[model samples]
Target: MIVKYTKPGRNLIMVPMLILLTGVSSCASRPPSSVLQPVRLVQNESEKITLLAITNRDRESDGKGFGSRWAAKLTYEKYRFSIPSERKSTAIVYPSKNPDPRRQFVVTARKQLLDSELIDDATSAANFDGTVAVFVHGYNYSYQEALFRTAQMAADASTLSPPILFSWPSAASVTGYVTDRDAALYSRGELERLLGALAKDSRVKRIVLFGHSMGGFLSMEAAAQLKLQGRRDVMAKLQIVLAAPDIDVDVFRSQLRDLGHMQTPITLLVSKTDRALTISSVIGGERPRIGRLDIDDPMIR
Candidate 1:
């Protein structure tokens, strides 16, 4: 089924860095253009899968395409998505698998001119429950990694709600940690725009904001921004989940004080064995990160 977008609302100002589209092929026969890769691919075995992603990384001019799978599929063989550091917001549809090499397969792809209300309309139309889970990735993640992770997590959860990925411009390298951290901070405004749109949409009944590692920092920041904007109605319908958050204990405590007691439940998932956090602790002058807290400590109690 081809999903189309209606007119976008006037208030939607946040630009979606990437848009993904997915549809099923009617026949089992392999497409003539299908090239077998040596390694196993995620979703390679599945006949149909739902894919949705938004990314802000610079586009590549090479044949490989953008960080998003659906965007890569939709982009022409040249594989261009967005320009390097282009701030113009865009939304595009996924390309269907086509067999003919001679004919262009991606010409039919179109931008999803959208606003939050339009997004809610589409989500409401897709599922009766009207729940949308937004997943934000942490530091050192390439755009593709974030996209695939969200897809896999959503599949594992087996939820009726659609999964959306909000990927910042992470340097995607261990050495780039500092740069990624700054990028994460810079991304707060964009995140706010996205969350605000989703929150304001009437058709959206529930929203789950999930973040991993440094992404947790972004999530909490966005949550605080929502509260500051007097968008408690939006916060009321949200459920915040932070997994292995890479946040300073002091910062976390401050965020809590500002948020006060929230109507929405916030679930924090932490583990001592998280090596990344272990290294982070060392970098931060031996102070324990929030993700690696000691519950027995009186301060924690």
Candidate 2:
């Protein structure tokens, strides 16, 4: 979502920023560790979900956790969440203090995962299916929010294997659209490295790469990088799913041209009613965004 300021209509650029400003005003982000502080109590009615998170963000100065800054090195951390029994579908509630596990999500456990422990734990979680789901979140996300959101999606899907989250450094601010865009592009190679790591393990037979919003753009970039590099061995085990991706139409066509010869077909989850993408299109001088693609258009068909 690199919003280049153009002269066509200065009015057009303000539209998205206005929306972003209004959006952030209504929903302010909680304190850094507000929802992330570990809750030792495990509720009987709540379901416990564990996941693997891989990130390129800088760790805290004290090395206790991660921050919003970008980093060159990759990190692996394991997390467990307690999903509230009373939680509504598609609703996520972050606690400000004294979380109620039966009514709100809670972080039960978290720790760094060593290289040797990653495979053993990943294999055990995959169980008989040998499938691993990796999620890449879009722009305007903090590391904690990404972790919680990934766990929620995994819980909703009832996935069989452990979910791995690829968290890139995002400014996590409404005004940081360009910063997030650069960070997303910067993390594509790291995403490829994550794939390479999982592909080497014999137990991981299937890898699903799910990216939402701008993260979908990163996913495609990494996929194209692998394709051009002749990484067929890793590509064979990969299945890509892009949900409401904020990718440009012409750029997507170019990427598809490069990826057309691959053995597996890509799954695109598009919607004409995605307002975020509608604004994104307007910001890009009214250029078409793939997420807002009209399937019935004659030229598109």
Q: List residue ranges in candidate 1 displaced over 4 A.
A: 1-47, 63-126, 295-301
Give candidate 2 misplaced runs (Cα > 4 Å): 1-26, 62-64
In lDDT terms, which candidate is top? 2
Please list the Cα RMSD from the true structure of every candidate, rounded to 1 decimal place.
13.5, 7.9
TM-score of each: 0.67, 0.86
Model 2 pairs whose backbones collide: none
Candidate 2 per-residue lDDT, tens place, 1-301, comes to 2111121112320111111111121136554654665767734636888888889999887665677788978888887888888877646677546778777778878888885576566778634487877888877778877887777776766767668899998777766767888999889989998888888888888788877778889999998898889888788888887766789989997888777665546666666666657666776799988766665667654
Which number leads on TM-score? Answer: 2
lDDT of 1 by residue, 1-301 (tens): 1111112121111101212111111123222212211122222232223435555554555623243222221121111121112112222122234322122112211133234433543374355476777788877666555554454454445556546778787766666667777888877877777777776777777787877778889989988887877887777777777666788988887887767777655666655656667766776788877766654557654
